[model samples]
Target: MTKMIVGLGNPGDRYDGTKHNMGFMALDLLAKEYQTDFKMEKTFIAEVAQTFVNGEKVFLVKPQTFMNESGRAVKPLLTYFNIDPEDLSVVFDDMDSPVGRVRLRQKGSSGGHNGIKSILTHVGTEHFNHVKIGIGRPKNGMKVVNHVLTKFDSEDNSEAQDGIFKAVDAIKYYIENNDFTKAMNKFN
Candidate 1:
């Protein structure tokens, strides 16, 4: 079965390397590991690259609708590709989990993430696959907006990188096995 792996992030250089863009970061690594470059698909308003992993066709996507309206791009791509929610996987940032922690789930609520919320709205279901790249909660006294947009400190940056890499591995495992429970058991 074909699968779509979406990386949700705001579109622009200003958001680059921020904690909120962990999804995009992980996609970049996954694409690089697959030896490909993203081509902007204006029809979907997203960057897309295609590759095969363990004989499964994988389409990597990065929505360009900013963080709040990512569904506009995601929903269209899912429909156009005729991919079921069961065959769709997404990678995104999560503040509740500690940095460097990556969790793969068959499905879940958005947990207050606007991007994931929008995606759920457009996709019309919560029963989809997801890989959450942990960004950690804001330190006391820091605002959520500021904390998510800010680059991590030197120490935390390394951990976040590790998390993204782990997410990449999880994606590969999920594609190869088509088993979220097994992938989560091994990687989460």
Candidate 2:
């Protein structure tokens, strides 16, 4: 069963509310709904919250190592906990998927996501669970870097609010049942 959940995003005020930080935002909402709070942990380079979901211990982690190097925070946590790859689920933003859409996968390659690439390098495998939150591609052939770092405007923000909540619910369901298929069916 899954035990650790890591949300990938750059840390700090500058990235706040941007498309790339959607993972962090969704995880924060999940933590709040569970009545828990994250504490900064020096070793992991992330804010971590521990709680039980349906009697299973769950760790909610937000990497502080910036987006590209997110695995620096995740690898150690997995090692310390002795968690299997299947027990670690990463949530992160996806440029290809349309905004407000979510995709869940049992395991796969990073598909060019730097954060997931780093994690795969650290963990030595592509077999791990992931929750991909869509941020949508930018118009006019804009660079993905610029697109992801941009903040959502009013209309996008409204859509995101609802989307984030749905992602949170999906996480809860996954933790409780270890059923990614059910989660995708329900939330996708």
Candidate 3:
């Protein structure tokens, strides 16, 4: 069976390296590690790359739609590929955990994440997998929007990179084992 691994983030150079794009960053790293590259697929409204893990077919996707509207791209891709929602895994930034932390869950609420919210609405389920890289909450009364869009400060960059790498490893583990619970037990 084939599986879809989605990384949540806004498209364009403007969004690169921002705290909100941790998912994209992790996917990029995964692609490079696997010696593959992403290509934009207009029909899917996403940048997609194909790779394999433990002999299983896998697709790595980065939705081209902006963050809040990610499902606009995701749902179509899922339908086109005839993939079950349970076979989908999502990577995204999470403010609920501190930097350098990676968390895994089989399913859960969006936790105020707009990108995940979009997926839940369009995909119509909370039963997929989540690989979250922590960005930590904004401090000193900073606005949430401002914090997400902004690049990580110098103090946070190293930690964020650690989190992203950990997230990628977690995804690899999940895809190879085909067991979300095992991945969660090992990584979370």
Candidate 1 C-alpha RMSD relative to the actual structure: 1.0
> What TM-score, over all chains together, does every model reach?
0.97, 0.95, 0.98
Q: Model 3 — which ten-residue stretch has the worst lDDT?
A: 171-180
C-alpha lDDT of candidate 2 relative to the true structure = 0.87
Name every residue pair that clashes in candidate 3.
Answer: none
Residue lDDT tens for model 1, 14-47? 9999999999999999999889899999999999
Model 1: colliding residue pairs: none
Positional deviation of residue 182's Cα in model 2 after best superposition, in angstroms: 1.9
Clashing pairs in 2: none
Off by over 4 Å in 2: none
Model 3 C-alpha RMSD vs. true structure (Å) is 0.8
Off by more than 4 A, model 3: none
What's the lDDT for all of these models? 0.91, 0.87, 0.93
Q: Which of 2 and 3 is ahead in TM-score?
A: 3
Q: Candidate 1 — which residues are off by over 4 angstroms?
A: none
Report the lDDT of model 2 for residue 27: 88
Per-residue CA lDDT of model 2 for 23-140, tens digit only, reads 9999899899889999999888999999987777899999999988888899999999888888888988888887878888888999889999999989888888889888888867
Question: Ten consecutive residues with minimal summed lDDT in candidate 1?
Answer: 171-180
Q: Could you tell me the lDDT of residue 38 within candidate 3?
A: 98
- The TM-score obtained by model 2 is 0.95
